[model samples]
Target chain A: MIIPYLELAISFLRVSLSAYGGGIAAISLIRHEVVVIRGWLSVEEFIRVVTLAEMTPGPLIVNTATFIGFRLAGVPGSLVATTAVLSPALLLLTALMLAARRLESRGQFRVRIQDAVKPAVLALMLMAIISFGRNAVTNLSTALIAALALAVLLVSRRKVHPVLVVIAGGIAGLFLL
Target chain B: MFVVFFRTGLLTFGGGYSILPVLHYELVDSRRWLSEQNYTDIVSKATAIPGAVSVNTAFLCGRVLRGKKGSATAVLGMAIPSVTTMILIAAYLFEYVHHPGVQRFMKGAAAAVAAQITYGVWLYARSAVRSVWVVLATAPLFAGAFFLGLHPLLLVATALVVGGPFVYRKAKLKAATSSPESEYSELME
Candidate 1:
């Protein structure tokens, strides 16, 4: 039990440390680890996991860590993984805040980095879309469902919460699609 | 303050960019924890970082409010509610999620997720591609990631290293001529 718990700690630690761009972009890294490498979840299970993460409210990555950890070693494992995943960011951000205090004059430096990295982050998100789309859009029906969801989200401009959009898609799948 | 972040965590429906409106409403509008500009600063910086955007925002906000202790408190407040709920949800999901109807519904949910991500692509692209050069340069990047199937980390690094200077030059040039005030605004807050 302890062994699996520790393993969950380490695995999620690595994932949280490595994942960038957050949200769906981080899902790719989690998929590569949990689904592809460890075989902890199969492809279909992975899709379900992503869907579950989307449907529920919280940080997607943290929710994923908790879910995977629970699957590995129950409640304790979930706690361990959550802590492990969060610790790095806590430590890094604290240290960065400390360091950044002294280098207060370097204001423009950070802006340049932000300007530089924005497009790359955008590209990463694009990759996530393509990869997930390939897996989810298996048939014309699924494709139409995807298209409808996209149109709603785009047209709404976030006026509609995504959870509703997801539920609508599920209903469409059940009845119309 | 802790309550504010806790509420933000609990209220954020879809995470990532979803947290923005809640933050805008609570911290910016209601409590006035920070000005709109300061809030945007925290958000953009949080987005640029490698971790969860909501967590990052909480950390930065906490830091600005008090210090390390505040940061820790805010992070815990933001994470705990969602973590507790997720454990229950995960346990429930593991049980009957194997049902055929449930599976089909989830499949549809997955397709919606793909659509949701595609929408995110449009939103991010609209914000990030500010100029013709950016559009030109990032097109190949889109191709490389979508077609050639390069690792995301590799692409991110290559873009940062290769595309950084191009955009920076453009931004600097525009800042010098057009809007000198806004150029350094990102870091000042």
Candidate 2:
């Protein structure tokens, strides 16, 4: 158990470190590792975890890591996995603080790096939506609900609380689906 | 600062960008730990880092406020509530999340989630792909991800290595040619 937990720790550390452009972009890498490579989770289960991540309040990566770690082992697994994923950010934060003062003048280089990564990140996000949409949008009612929800979010610019949207979607699902 | 970030973590919903409002209110508006200008700078810098945006924001703010220890405290405080909630869910309600009823709820919620993610697509595109050349270059990558079964990890890694320097050169050229009007001017305002 400890050995497997350590492996999980290592995997999450690698994933979190390589997860450029933030959590949403990281979802693809996670799916690749846990689903494609490790075979720890199926596509459906992975999508479900993605949903859980979205609904939760914390970081998507952390929430998904916790769930996967728990499913793999237990409480101890969860603790180890959480620590592993978070270690990079802590290390990076320290390095960033140390280097930030010296590197402050090179702001353009930093901005451009972010700019170059944006399109790829956007592509990954689109893939996530399409893949999940294909799975979730099975019937007419579900499709309508999805389109309506997309419209609502579009018009509102996601200002409305997400929990309300989830609740509303659930009620609609209960009645219609 | 620890208490403030803990509250921010506990109260925030939807994660990432959702914490922005709460952090702004407490750090900028209420406590005056950061001025509006400083807060904006923190946000931009946080976004530039990898990992979670909200957590990075907390970490950067903490470092700015105190030091390395402050960063650790802020991250821990922000993480505690969410981690506890997640672990509790895993312990008590894991099975139920996969039950028929809850799965149905997730089905609907998943659709909503998909919608929200679509909005993210546009949001990032607006910020990143301002030129036609970028769109043309990026469209193929998007298509490859969608159609050709290209892995996003590979795609993003390649983008970072290849595009990083390309964009840097472009920015430098643009800066050299254009007046020094300030790239961060919009953010400052």
Candidate 3:
């Protein structure tokens, strides 16, 4: 029991420390850790894990961590894994906040860097959309469902919450497509 | 403050920067806890860092708004929903999730997720510094990421280096911008 827990801690600590460019980008790194290194999950199982992560709330990386941890042990395993994944990040964040504070008098220096990199971040999001679209919208029927869902989201002035749209999409798929 | 982050975490279905619109709505538009500019600044920086972008945003925004305690509250609030929900799913739904009907339902959910993600990115792009140069950079980035398979990190580093002139020009114009923060001050502070 302790051995599994220890493995969980070490594996996810390594993941959090090394998985740069979070979310979908971390998927490959996570796959390497769980699938290749530990042989905890097969390739097919790993794909399911990622899909499950995508469907849930919160950070993709964290969701994946929780699921894998629970599978490894139980509820306690999940907590340990989540904490391990977050530990390194929290420390780094503290250091970063302090540095940002020291640069306070620099006058929009931080802001300018943000502006400079904003487009690249936008580009990354664009890639996420593209990659997600390819995986999710496979057939013409699924494509139509996605388009209608998008239409509802856009037409409602975004008054309709995305979760509702997703639920509707699921129901629509059950009967219609 | 905790409530704000809690709701954002609860609603961010696809995570990553999907929380962008939720945060904007909660912090910037509805409450005004953050200015429009400040939100984008936090978001952009969050994306570039090593940690989870949403968690990083929660921490930075919390630090800016209140203090360390605020950051603690915000990060905890941000984490709770995902941890509990995933745990529940793992214990119960993990077994049944592979069923055909459930899989179909999840598949449909994925389609809507793609659409919602499109909306999220659009919101951020609009609020970000919109300029011809940004527009110019976006197209090639898409091509490079798709065709050349460039890493997102590499792309961001390239953007920062290429956009180095902007930072340099501002420093030159200001006539004595702070020479990057010292390692000592960053640590000792």
The whole-model lDDT of each prediction reads 0.70, 0.69, 0.78
- Ranking 1 against 3 by lDDT, winner: 3
Give residue B72's lDDT in candidate 1 (0 to 100).
82
Model 2 achieves a DockQ score of 0.43
Supply candidate 3's per-residue lDDT for B14.
71
Tens-place lDDT digits, model 3, residues A70-130: 9989889988988888778778768766775677556433325676677678778788888
CAPRI quality level assigned to candidate 3 from its DockQ score: medium
Candidate 1 per-residue C-alpha lDDT over A1-177 given as tens digits, one digit per residue, 9 for 90 to 100:
467777777778888777665666678788888887788889888887776776566778878887888878888888888888777876776675567565545533433444565655666666656656787789988999989988887787556765567678877787644
Score candidate 2 by lDDT.
0.69
If ranked by TM-score, best first, what sequence of candidates would result? 3, 1, 2
For residues B46-113, could you state the per-residue lDDT of candidate 1 as single tens digits? Answer: 66566787788788888887877888888888888788888888877556656768767767776776
Docking class of 1: acceptable
Error of 1 at A64 (Å): 3.4
Candidate 2: residue pairs that collide: none
Ranking under lDDT, best-scoring first? 3, 1, 2
DockQ winner = 3
What would the DockQ be for model 3?
A: 0.54
For the candidates in turn, chain A alone yields TM-scores of 0.71, 0.65, 0.84
Per-residue C-alpha lDDT of model 3 across residues B1-189, encoded as one tens digit per residue: 998888778777777766666676678766788887778778887776665878888988998888889888988899899999999998788777678787788788778777877776777777774678788877777678889988777777887888767755764555444444543333333
Q: lDDT score of model 3? A: 0.78
Q: What's the best-to-worst order under DockQ?
A: 3, 1, 2
List the TM-score for candidate 3's chain B: 0.81
